[model samples]
Target: MTAPQRARSAQPALDRVDRRILDHLADHGRSSIADLAEAVSISASSAQRRLRRLESEEVVRGYRAVLDPIAVDRGLVVHLAVTLVDHTTNTVGRFERHVLDLAGLVSCHHVTGDVDYLMRVDVADVEALDVLLRRTLARLPGVARLTTMVATSAVVDRVTQV
Candidate 1:
């Protein structure tokens, strides 16, 4: 099956309350149910039920602590444009599997345009990036070429939709 088909089949639709809970979490993951209820304008019990339902449905995957990459010493942020030599299902699958296994690859999106894939990568330095390119990315089966753009500043990186 295609990637989009596989993703859609795995994930279920979100209800209104579920969406509100998700939005609340996206804005502030540590927000209590009482606060969340106040924000969503629902009773505390109702908010609890909605949050439980969202969790059970996998709509609310898991909560995580967002950290500063630079503070943690992972200073380099690279956006990579990856073009595959082949677009067949097998080739795409192989590339996807390999990309998923790579440690420095933060996010990978199968995108349209000249490039087949867009990858967000993070590393300690340029040396680490070189190692990632040579040892990890280059070893992938169908990768034809990769072009990288390093981010100098983060203008906006919002987790929640507004």
Candidate 2:
């Protein structure tokens, strides 16, 4: 998966210690305070305090274990570009609400393009995808069109440190 492009305005300046801490955590979220402190050349207590501050400030949101889709029986992954017939707020809200209800939807983004929304969906096979497209997505009110493209492979899937 490609990293979501972040706006430059949303980023804040990082001190050297902050950079080091982030780099260490990026390499291993399970790293203990002592290990992180040693890597960053700081006291364990200091490292713990810094970590707490980062979490409190929403810099470190949460940790997750990355899983293989095939192992989980959800191998077929597709990207869908959706365009709504109406651009009204109510219509968009209704569509978004319905999209959120679908089980296969992994991520949805309101983007700039011919399509108003981009959705990432994962299913077991093409049959499930057809059901999702015809029954769920196509049935959405005010939906003009939806274009889907299956992903063959993920080239880079890394979260930026900092």
Compose the digit string of candidate 1's lDDT tens values, residues 8-109.
Answer: 998877777677778788878888989999988899999999888778987778887777776665678889999999899999999998788777667899
Q: Lowest summed-lDDT stretch of 10 residues in model 2?
A: 1-10
Model 2 C-alpha RMSD vs. true structure (Å) is 5.6
Q: Write the per-residue lDDT of candidate 2 for residues 1-162, one digit (tens) a residue.
A: 234446454555668998899988886898999999999999999999989888877788888666677777577888899999989999999998888888867899999979999988888889988888888889998799999999777776452221
Top model by lDDT, which number? 1
Displacement of the residue 117 alpha carbon in candidate 2, Å: 0.6
- Provide TM-scores for the models: 0.81, 0.81
